[model samples]
Each structure stands twice: as structure tokens, then as C-alpha cells.
Target: MDPRISKQRTALVLDQPFFGVLALRLKVVEDASCKTFWTDGESLGYNPAYLGGLNDLETRGVLAHEVLHVANGHCWRQGDRDPKLWNDACDYAINPIVLEAGMLLPKGVLVDTRFKGKSAEEIYGILAQEKRQKEKQQKQQGKGKQDGSKPDAQSWQQSASQPKQQPDSTPGGSSAPQSSNANGANTPSANPEPTATPDAAPSCGEVRQYTGDDKALKEADWKVAVLQAAKAAKMRGALPGALEAMATDAVEPVVDWRPILHRFAQESSPTDYSFAMPNRRYLHMGLYLPSLNEPAVGDAVFVRDSSGSVWDETQAQFAAEIIAVNAGVQPRRLIVMDCNTRVTQVQIFERGDAVELDLLPVRGGGGTSFVEPFERLEKEGIRPAFLVYLTDMDGPFPDEAPDYPVLWASTTPLKRARKAPFGEMVEVIC
Candidate 1:
């Protein structure tokens, strides 16, 4: 009834050195009658029946494999790949490393000699090529249907190692032919159109994830948790070189646009006073009024570079990014301005108000010039904390940089060749 509890006890009793700490970090849940063990970035789902036969070492090894899955972000990295193949490729890359680290995988666990030392990505490519070849052969024989698109690259590593183990669907709706060394867990087939999970935190390697079921694992920002756990493991001399090398990328992952925008808003030094926040000193004297000092909020200005290149889709995505970033900063007001040859339209909203561009009117579809927007701001005597210019950096610049900070968010391929005369540059990858 409590197989996960038993596994934890085993990890503590037989392998307290490393697994003890790792077990504590992972959220382990029990599924009494499942065919395999699995993890969904947030929690490790275990089937007691599948694990009952393994000894303590083997059990610990299985547990480690699941942890490695979450740590390595295999769950999130499956980007547009076949789930079965992605998992297999991940196992191929991780299993050998696990065995080398002294843990023991159960017998019959998939371990290919050819994929030795290759990354999941490299292996996935090989597997994908094999799948393509097989698909081509099947088509020639008139035994299969073509989807018009190429076989998924993510399937590359999975099928390369095991071309014959086609996933057979079980009556229970789960796919059969379990992912190689996916600890024999039963996984659902890949979605025809696999997209990243919305609101799913960037796989930060964190230990917290809310699975909704209180009995399940809690939610967290994985990026922070993974980095912290790795650091802690290293400090305790428990982190393996293999794991360290894998975690290095997550520790210093790409600079996210949200943080960049939030920081831009945060850098503002607001001096406005609000009667809502009365001075305590004056309140004691029976006088409640707006404080002369201590501003609780600031304004954010978004300058839209509405050139022909900035398509509708790109514009909407940029607006969403602005809303998300502004939500984090909790600014007092938001002003959206459109500029192509010049500032064409301006819409103002309060902090919590929704800025829906579709409902509002937008002006401008002319040649681009970065000079007009700043010039308009100066002419209008509007000094926002900072200005976020959403553009492709394809226009003439102002003679001098503005007094306030500016964030040049571009979507052009020639980013490096183009230059912003001043202000930080953030690539807006929509």
C-alpha cells in the first residue's frame, strides 16, 4: 500500500550518502498496480508491483533514474518530439551515466553500446533518421500512410537504438512497448501536435510542483530548485561529474525576457505621492494625507514599433510579454504607444487593467524611424520610469540616446549586424 514509503526507507537504509538527500528533494507518489515507474517533472509515479522484485540497490537505481529525468529536464525538452522516442533517447544518455556512478539498473534495462557517451539530442537525431528510413520503406511497400511532414527529430534518438520495438497500444488507453529504460513505466502516446505546457514553469530543476492532488508532489520553479540541489550536492561532495556537466546549462540558462523587462520597470525611482497611503507620522497627529515621500508604484511605457515587418502575431505576442512583465513589476500605470514613422496612437491604463490591443484602435503602417517616439515623449513632457521599444531594430536612431533607460526588443535575423546606439538589447523570440 505504501511502496514509495518503503522505497524511501530503502534509500535511507542502504544508500543514505546520495539517494537519501535526493529522495528528500523528489516528490514520490505510489501507484500500486502500474506496469512501470515514471516522473512528470513534478513527481515520480511508482508502481509497487513493478518494483517489488528489485533488491535495494536496483530500487535505488530506478529511483535515481527518475530523479535524473527531472534533473535533466527530459520531460520539458521533448519539444515537438515523440514521447516514447524522447524518453528512450533520454534513457540511453542517462542510464550509462547512472551505472558509472555506481548505481545499478535492473536487468533488461535498455543500454545500447553504440549510444555510449552521446547526448540525448545526438542520439535523438540518429533515432529520427532511422525512423525516417523505416517510414520511407513502409511507404514504398504501400504499408503505411504519410503525414506529409518529416518524422519528428525528437524521435531520432529513441528509434535509433530500438527500431523494432514499435509501441503497441494496450486496451487501457496507455501505449505499450514502454519507453526504453523509462523504468518500464506506461506512458501515453505523443500528441500529434506537441506544444509546450502553458504556465508550466521553465524546467528550472526545482523540486516543487503542484500536481493538484495533495497526495501528489508540490509545484515549484524547477530552474531554481535544480540549481540549488546541484549546488548543495556539490558542496557535500555528492554531485557526480556527469550530473554537474548536465546541470551547468540550467544553472546559467538563457536570460529570460520577463526578467529583463521586470528589471527595467524595477529600476525606476518613482517620486509620486498617493493619498491612499497616508503618512503614519501625520496620522498620529489626526491628519491623514498623501505622503510627501515613499512612492508605492511607478509607470511603464511600451513603445510599439509598428513597421510592416511587425506582423499581427508578433504584435500580440509582444503585448502579452509586456502584460506578463508589467504584472510582475506591479506598476501603477501602463501606457501603450504605437509608432512607425512617428508616434501614431497612445492608450493608457491603470496597473490592474487589461490592455487588449484588438479591442482598441491602433494607428500607423508607414516607414520606421526610432527617432520619432523619443522625440514625441520629450515633446509631450512624459518621463516614464523606462521605455520598452518593441521593434526589429530596422530604422534610423535619434541623434542622442534618451535620458531614460530603453530596452530594444528586436525580432530581426541580423541582430548582431544591427546596432542600438544606446540601451540594452533583448531579442524578442516570438
Candidate 2:
């Protein structure tokens, strides 16, 4: 029996929480391209002879490591970063989490305590800084000429382009059953196993049996699979904290606007005494004195574009968000402004008042200028806790940012295509 298959079976037998069996479904491809073992966050690819040296636990650990790469959405998160450094960061992030699960990894796997609890994005920043420092030191030492040419950093695309192989040809060969005979019975044959045609593509359902690539997992199916896996691991009380965090992040993905709105409203709220509502405690004493209310959100301003690009329904949606934000903090006042090249209509509504858009006038149709709203606020002597601007972001921005936090809710399909000089951006997907 092949040691690779034997050890893999042994590893499965020793599964702490069934990670071995769960991860084994990834297409195991045998190729000499990888020196030891590597995954493109989709499939596990290795040189069979290299992995054959690992013990049963070590082999199982390696399998879990590859599966985790896909489970945690590492491939999808690698946007525009140096691939080698990204890979290193990802390894640093994952290796310790698996090792902590009482699994054994082969020696020389990257593991660093400093990167613990940090997301891959954070680790990538750290690695990028180190790479920059190394480059600077090399320049000071005159390692290269002042010419334009420089040694290239690691490329993610290069690694992503590696050819995938069938499980039968993987590092140690497949443990799957052999082909069925013409009589429809499984049988051993002296002939070589037939290989899939190079140009052949796997069907949708077949993708699960192949590499756990991002394309295969993108259709909201992975969420269901990952949630089930996480639930099983939790039941065994063997899920590592790091893996748990990643699983929670995948299962209940957070939207950008949620936290941004909460923080902005909370931080900008104010406190004051109100004569209208006396303290209930003091009311028992028959005193009609003013009561101190907990700090509530201060005045907040929201600006919208009344241009041809923005529709009434979009304006209504934006108004609803403002209403919600106001309700959350109970702001003293909520000001809504409509503008294009200049301020067209300005309406002020108290916390309990309804915003009637039909009653307010809509102005500006020639061109869009984001500077108009800020100027109008300053001219009207109206100060706000924070400002939120809703637009398609197709206008010229002010030369300088105002002295308040601004949240730009864009209706654009691509959020990254435009940027505000200051403040955060939230995409309106609806």
C-alpha cells in the first residue's frame, strides 16, 4: 500500500472534528510544479514524492491548511497585493490556527505569533512594509544600478495560472476506486488509468469534486457548506478560535454601512436637559423641574443630488436611512438639503417630524458641484454633528474637505471607480 494513502487514511481515523474527511474532497493534483505542497486557495497541488515524507498527522495538517484557504475566502481577498507577500501573510495567518488544533505540520511552515488575531489584510500591510524597507536598504547598499530595471516581487497571477491535475495523478496518487468494467462492476486493470482531456471543463456539480476554486464557491453555495462545517466543528468542541472567527465572518458576512452608520451616530451624539419631560424619579416628589436626558445625537445634515441621474425612489431610500439614523441617536435636528450646481432646496425637520419630499422644491439641472452644499451650510450658519451626501458621485468635489465627517452613499455600480477626498464611502447596491 502507498504510504501516502495509508497515512491519509490514518489521518482520517484520527480526525479531531472531521476536518480530514471534510477537506479530502478538494481535488488532489499531483504535479512537479510545486517543490513541496501549495494550494491556489482552490485545489491542493503537490509533488507526491515530497509529501510522501510527512507523517500521518502532518499530511492531515497539510490537507486542513489547503481546505482552510478556500473556506476563509483568502483567494477572493487578495486584491492588488504582492502575491508572494500575500501568500506569506496568509500562511502566517493560517498555520498557527491549524497547529493549535493539535495537528502536526511539516517543519519550515511559516508561523508567527505577532500576526495572531490579525486579518490577512492587516498582515499584508505588515509584509508590504517589510518589503519596502528591504528595498530601501538594498538601494542604500548599491545592490543594483540606478537603471529602471528592478527585481520583480512575487506575482499572484503567476501562481494562480498553475495547471490543475486530476486526483489520480496527485503527489501520492488517488485513493478513489478504479474505473468500472464494461459489465458495470469495479475491477482492477493492468492498463493505465484514463486521464481527463485537457480542454474538458467540469460541470457545476462536478466542481465540488474538483478543486475548491473561488469560481466554484461564488454562487452562495459555499456559505451553506461552510456553515454546516462550522456547526459540526463546534459540536466537537475542537474548532480553533481563529478558525471560528473566520467561519463566523464567512457565514454572517458584514456589510460596510452597518458599522459605519452606528459609529458615526454614536460618537456625534450630545447630552442636555429638557423641561418638557421631567425626571420620573423627581416626579414622585411632586417637582416639575427639568430632567437630564442621556446624551443624544446632535444636529446631523444630509445632502442629496436632485440631478437627472438620481431618481425619486433613490431619494426616498436615502431619506429613510436619515430617518433611521435620527431615530437611533434622537438627534436634536435633521436637516435635508437638495442640490446640483447650487443649493436648490433646504428643509429642516425635528426628530419626530416626517420629511415631505413632494412639498420641498428640487433644483439644479445644468451641472453637478459638490461644493454647493457645504457653502450653503456655512452661509446659513448651520452646524451639524456629521454630514451624509447621497449621489452617483459624478460631480466635482470641493477643493478642501469640510470640518465634519461625511459619508458618501453612492448609487454607482462600481464603488471603487470614484473616491471622496475625505470621509468614508458606502455603496447603495439597491
Candidate 3:
């Protein structure tokens, strides 16, 4: 090594070879005429167009929002999933945290807008009305950059990306996560939002107990409302569901998924990642990435540990967002692998299309392992450029993971991956 060689000068270095599983190197374009923030696997496109440079807090929130996407498995989760749908899920999924952290939304998208009409900056009241009241009543309270933008003392703080310290759990709740999978099935729970706000009439601070007069949007109708909003955001492009996402609802984070590693010693986060109706799991589940890009279409097949229970709706949305991101990149090929076989793959799913990818492979499994995928890829002569092996920290990995990049997304902060050589690994709670 050159005596004076700097880490910045070195193209790549790793704690474990497999840890760096991402395919695109981010690009940074900063000057007078650039547009809004967008990413290709390799780089970023910046706009000097906005004259106001971010103040430290604003900058951190914006960065946190983007980083949260990568850390949350928002990118890879979209494998063969519909892009638009998945992105819509994320905007809704991360809304609480983003708003809590102070990311402001456009003027009218807030769900409570029809009522308040932007007169009050009521923090997270729209999302968790009771929570806001409780916190305000309590009078209690509550990182920065490196890379293309410029490195600073915050460079060291980037470690804050996934803080070693656990975050505060959901307000006014017990330690137990609301529900868990039973035999590879979806466990239904009332929506994470506490079943009170979906129909927040023009009242100040009332937690409703459905009256005979109760009239809420039908589930199908609510879905349509959400879609109409997401479509309005997506057609304008640039992060898809941003407007419909409603950044005003007190983005304060809820549960941080990082604790499941040790907190649920008897159980494990599911390796089978899927979308459920929103839950309190996201705040803790957040991850921070600098950026992401599209790999060549079919260049990689995202395999799921569908052996465990799954979040059906959330998983469906995960698939959709990936499509949204990829649609922007226009990958050369796209292949989705399930435990059983490939289905409805090779083509991108357009929004509103009734997509039914084969789900057989998602079933017929009890335990977990990485072997089936090695054999699958080998059968196709496809050596993945990198792999994101999401797991629950309970299963043992292959005696050897191929010499490629792999991030171990396990429940708790990762300890040691016994085997799986060469690839970079990250522990993500499923």
C-alpha cells in the first residue's frame, strides 16, 4: 500500500469482502443547472437549481430520509414487485418517521389537509393524535455527511446510520411486537396507526370509538384514495410517491427494527420479507444508504426466504417500488425467483396492471438455508454480482457463500457470519 494512500483514494476496502453488495457506484452531479435528487446505481444527480443550501438540520433530515430507504430494504424489496405500488407503500411506511424528523411535505398532501387546511403545524397529530398529545403533555424531546456532497466531522457520524444504541420503542405500548407469523402465514393486526385516525373528522383531539353513525372509507375505497394520490405523485416522477406521502404528519419514528436481534431471543424477524398493512416495525427497521442504482435487467434474481411468515401487502408494495426505481433505470433484464419457480417475470409491471407473479415457491418450506439459491443460480449459469441475503439470524448460512458481495440483513445488529466467504455482509432484521 502507498504510504500516503488515503481511504478516499482506494477504490474499495472491506471488513468482509461480501459486505459491499451494491452494484452501482453513485454519481454526484452538482452545479447550477441540475434537477432534484435522483440516483442510478452508480451516481447522483444534484441541482444547484435550488439556491438555498440545506442548514445542518434540514440537510440531515433529507439525508436521513434517503438513507432510510436503502436501510429499510426499500430498494431490493422491490424485486419483481410492482414499482409504483411498492414506492407508494414506502411513502406511507416511512411517513411517521420522516415527519417526526422534520421533513416537510408539499402544501396540500397531508391527509388532514381537508380539515386543517395548513393552519396548524401540529407535529404528528394527523398520524398519531394521541401520541402527539401525550408527548406534548410530557414536554420531552429528542448526523451528517461525507461523499459527493463533501466530507465533514459528520463523516464519522455516518456510523449513526444504524446507531448501536437502540431507539425508543412505540409510544404507550408494551415491549412485545404486535404480532408474529404462525406457520408461514400472515398475522393480522389492526393497522399500526392505532385504528383511530383513518377517519379523523373535523375534530380537535378525539379518539373515536366507532359510533352507530361511524362512516369510514371502505377498505377498497381507501386503497383507491391512496392510489389516486400516489399516481399523482408518480406521474410527476422523482421519488414517485413524495407528494402523496404527506410529510406533515409528525415523522417521528416508532419502533426501530434493530432490536429484534436480541430482544426477541426466542423468536426471530422473518426471513420472508413481504408487505403487510402498515405496522410499527419500520422506525426501528430503517437503514441508511448513500444511494442506489439499477442493475442490468435479469442481471440478478432476488430470492426470498419465503419459508417463514410474510407481510403480504407490504411485500407486494416492496415489489412495486423496485419496479418504480428500475423503470427509471430501465434494467436490461428482470428475473424474480420464488422457491417454486419463475413466473410473471422478464417484463416490468405497469401501475394498475393486475400483477400476479407466481407465489408457489414462497411456500413449502419450514426452515431456512442459502443452498437452494446457489443451486438455482448455478443451474442458470448466473453468478450474481452481489446478493442481499435477508434473514432472521436464526438459520445457519451455507458452508461457503460464493465469492461475491452479500449483505446479511439479520434482525439484531449482526454478530459474526460463521461462513459465507468473500461477500460483504449486513445484518438486516427481516
Candidate 4:
């Protein structure tokens, strides 16, 4: 390891342990051929001269920037996208985060305030759209020239004599010029301004594409590493605010809940074989095989929080998912309980009964208490296959875990879901 790099890694371990834990995982190699620094989710390669150019603070920022690319799984997440553009988007998304952690990036590093708090995929879409527009404008300009539409010699000379607007050399600086339409209304110019291109933009580090078949495995490993790093930082009381939310998100990623709900329903429903009911088809073949006894899909309990905190759209989505789950699982009984401080309303849908939200009554506009639904289930002797509680997770949880599986489909921010005493929690986006 280069002495400078080694020194910075130690500094990170002491100051920012979360990033330090991830940074130390990357095997460092001093390569003069590497223009700046780069990480391929495994190793960090840097030019010694480039490392020498940056001051201590800037060098630390560059190191952290490379670690963030790996930590964020940017290398593995670039699926079928333009590699250069994806890397640029990843930089834009990571730079502000690095800056927010109180580190100073080298001059001209990619930093767009618009991309702050956005995922790399989101940033990539914005960058890709801008690139397409720029290409379209260039093509139109080329076609106009071919059509013999040329500027007058005097106008051309005057335009040529005018000083060109220097591209904003500072990171995150806006260079776009505003123009007026026929109605004299000022609007953003259709002509793409000269901003940061891959060649023009000086990145702190590059996110190299992962070319392995085990992209998912690699991504999972990084997520685990991130969690472990977070734990270590928390132990030392050094985790940054930016990293806290990010770490929580890494653990509970935003995913479609339909498939998860289906899986839970399928897994919770019991299946057995009964020797008393011998297979008739096997009996004809002189084989005494036991008959498969699949019981009716058991009761599925859905507890809705009727407290004012839960959004109407969230409730609607919850109802829609419940209906979908019921259709798929075809449960013997679908019990819908609306509760706030106590059970406000209980609607039972027996097998073959239509499950519709529009017909269901919405009740309660009071304080939240999750204990009521569980208490009611125990009192009624209802051993459901699974119970899904749709809430903001703001209320008090049951004192003890229920016998059946519990899935908390919370509409609140992910950080709030951590408060659930017992259950698998998923963020339900409206």
C-alpha cells in the first residue's frame, strides 16, 4: 500500500468508521496508468501523481467517494445502461453525500444539488434524458446547415468576435443560458449548454462496471458489509447523519410488496399427507400411496390503522394488495380489522365472498394502539396464517409476539419501522 493511502485509511477508520470499514475492504493498488482513482467493487486503483496532487482533506474525500460507489452498489446496479453515463450519474449522486459528511472534494468533481438524496438509477434517468435532447439538437443543427440556411457574413463575423461564455469550472455550477420564445416569455433554452461531459468533467473516482454473473450476490455482500460498518460506527458513536438513513434503507430496500405478500401467504398455509385418504390413481397401480391433504387457505388477517397519520392513498393501496392476496391465496376467511385506540370495525369475508374496499366502511379518527387487533385475534381464537398490519408504526406494539407470522406494511419512513417490536416491516409507498 502507498504510505499516503495507508495514512488516509487510518484517518478514515478513526474519524469516519462506517466509510472506513468499507474503504479498508478494497485492495489498494498504485497504478500510474489510472488517471485518478477508481473502484470495481473489489479493488481501488489510483495514480500516485493524482494522489500527490490533492491536499489531505481532498484526498480523504476522493477515498471516501470511491468507497461510497462500492457501498452504494453502483458497480453492480448499472444494468444494460451506457457505462460512462451511469458512472457520471453515480458520481453526481455520491458527491453531495461525500460533501455532506464534511469532506472537501477536489476541484471540478461532479456535484449536482438536484441529484442530492436521489438514487443512482434516478439520477441516470435525468442524465440520459439530457443526453438524448443534446443529441437531437446537434442533429437538427447539422440538418439546418445542410439545407443551405447560413448566417450572413456580417452576423457571423459579429458572433465570432463575441467572447465565448466560459463553462462553469466549479463543481455543481450551472452553465445553462435562458432564452425567450416568440411571446417574449423567458424559458430554458432548447439548445443543450456546455456542462460536464465525461471528458470535460473531472471526477474524484470512477465506478467500474462489474462484469460477473454474481452481481446479486456481490450486491448482497456489500449490503451486509454496510450494515456491519454501520454497527461498528454506532458502537463508537461516529456514524454520520447521512449514513444513518442510508444504512437503514440498505437493510430495507424499496420493493414491490405483492410478491412478498404472495410468498408469505403460500409459506404460512400448512400442507400434509393423510394415509387414511389413499390416492385412488396409485391404488389402481397397486401402490398404497398416501393422499395429499391440502387444507383450505387459512384465515388472513389485515389490520388497518384508522389513525389520522395514515394516508388515504396508503390505505387504498393496502386494500388493493389485500384483495390481490386474497385472490391469489383464496383464504378460507379474510378478516379485515380497522383499529385506532381499539378495534373500530371488523369485516369478515368468508371463502367465495367478494373482497372489495369500496364497500368496506372506514372508521376511527383517534390515537393508535396496535395491541387491540392482536388481543381481539387471541380472544376470538383466530389463528390466522399471517397478519398484516398496515400502519405508520407510530402506535404501541403488542407486549408479546403473536403465534402467527406478522408483516407490518408501514406507510411511514423506514426509520420508524425499526420500532416494531416483532414483525417483518416493509415500507408501503403511496
Computed on alpha carbons, the lDDT of every model, listed in order, comes to: 0.61, 0.61, 0.34, 0.76
How close is every model to the real structure, measured as TM-score? Answer: 0.41, 0.46, 0.28, 0.53
Q: Across residues 1-430, which tens digit of lDDT does each residue of candidate 2 receive?
A: 3457446745553565546545654556776756566655445666678666777667777777766666666655665556666666667677777788777877667665556665565455545544544567688547444432353222345546878653323322222222223442223333322121112311101111223354545625555667777788778776777678777766655355645666776766656788878878878788888887676566788887765344444565567667677667777787887775666677777766665423343444434568978987787787788888887677788887888778887755332226778887876632
Mark the regions of model 2 whose C-alpha exceeds 4 Å error after superposition: 1-10, 143-219, 254-430
lDDT head-to-head 2 vs 4, winner: 4
Candidate 1: minimum summed lDDT over ten consecutive residues — where?
169-178
Cα RMSDs of all predictions? 15.3, 21.6, 26.6, 15.3
**Per-residue lDDT for 365 in model 1?**
54
Error of 1 at 247 (Å): 2.7
Candidate 2 C-alpha error for residue 232, in Å? 1.4
> What overall lDDT, based on C-alpha atoms, would model 1 receive against the true structure?
0.61
- In terms of TM-score, which candidate is strongest? 4
Q: Write the per-residue lDDT of candidate 4 for residues 267-352, one digit (tens) a residue.
A: 88887998988999978789999988888878999988775445444566678878888888888888998876677788888887
Highest-lDDT candidate: 4
Q: In model 3, how large is the Cα lDDT of residue 216?
A: 28
Cα miss at 237, model 4 (Å)?
Answer: 2.7
- For model 1, residues 1-430, the per-residue Cα lDDT tens digits are 3655566546643443344554556566776654567777666677677667767677777777777776665655565566566666677777777787778777656566656655565456545545554566677545323543334443566768764522221111112111222331223223211122212212211122233453212223565667776777677777788777666654444445666667667766465677877888788789988875546566678888654445444576677777776666666777788776666677777865654533243455545678877887788887777889887676788998888878888754322326788988886543
Ten-residue stretch with the least lDDT total in model 4:
166-175
Let me know the TM-score candidate 2 reaches against the reference structure. 0.46
Q: What's the C-alpha lDDT at position 19 in model 1?
A: 43
